[model samples]
Target: MASMARNPLPGTIRKDGRRAFYVYLSPPLIRELKKAALDEERPAYELVEEAVEALLKSRRIARPATDGVA
Candidate 1:
């Protein structure tokens, strides 16, 4: 079976030099994200970033880069 960890989406840096990462989500998760973003009146990217940070902090997800090192 293919490992989920190896199924990351391709990402690239934006023209403005901001790093962007892509994550493929299921239809349900996409709907939840859109609803949450709208309810909070914030961009979906911002909510995504917050969720990612929380996950990293809780050790639920491992970041590509370790502290002060990539």
Candidate 2:
């Protein structure tokens, strides 16, 4: 979400408290996240939210994308 940090467009932070972002995960990563969610008995979205929250809390500035990946 470096783009969001750099330029928080007016359309971000939707009224329903959602932001639109996309990630292109390698297949193995996708499977791992899914398995983790299932093992923890939680929705995938919740698991992902936790990860994103952790990243935000780390206070690491997101770098710009290179070769179309971040």
Candidate 3:
């Protein structure tokens, strides 16, 4: 079987140097993130960034000391 080439939908992703992806979140997780973000006075994306950074750290992904430092 041959796969057909298709153009990506606008806002789905980009042809530039940025990549975007999606994750399916359960309601409970969504609520948890919202509460935590509120407590920190930060956006949910900031929490997500911290999570990904922690994950990589746990897996021993090498990173510079200043990688997540402000």
Q: Write the per-residue lDDT of candidate 1 for residues 1-70, one digit (tens) a residue.
A: 3564465334545566556566799999999999999999998988988987887777734555567653
Error of 1 at 58 (Å): 1.5
Query: What is candidate 3's lDDT per residue for 1-70, written digit by digit as tens?
Result: 1232255456755565345556999999999999999999998877997899898886664654556762
Best by lDDT: 2
Off by over 4 Å in 2: 1-16, 60-70
Q: Distance from true position, residue 48, model 3, in Å?
A: 0.9
Q: Candidate 1, which ten residues in sequence have the lowest lDDT sum?
A: 1-10
As a TM-score, model 1 comes out at: 0.58
lDDT of each: 0.75, 0.81, 0.75
Cα shift from native, residue 2, model 2 (Å): 17
lDDT for 2 (candidate 2): 78
Judged by whole-model lDDT over C-alpha atoms, candidate 2 comes out at: 0.81
| Candidate 1: regions farther than 4 A off | 1-17, 60-70
How many clashing pairs does model 3 include? Answer: 0
**Window of ten residues with lowest summed lDDT in model 2:** 57-66
Error of 2 at 42 (Å): 0.8
Candidate 2 local lDDT, residue 15: 92
lDDT of 1: 0.75
Cα RMSD, each candidate = 7.4, 9.2, 7.3
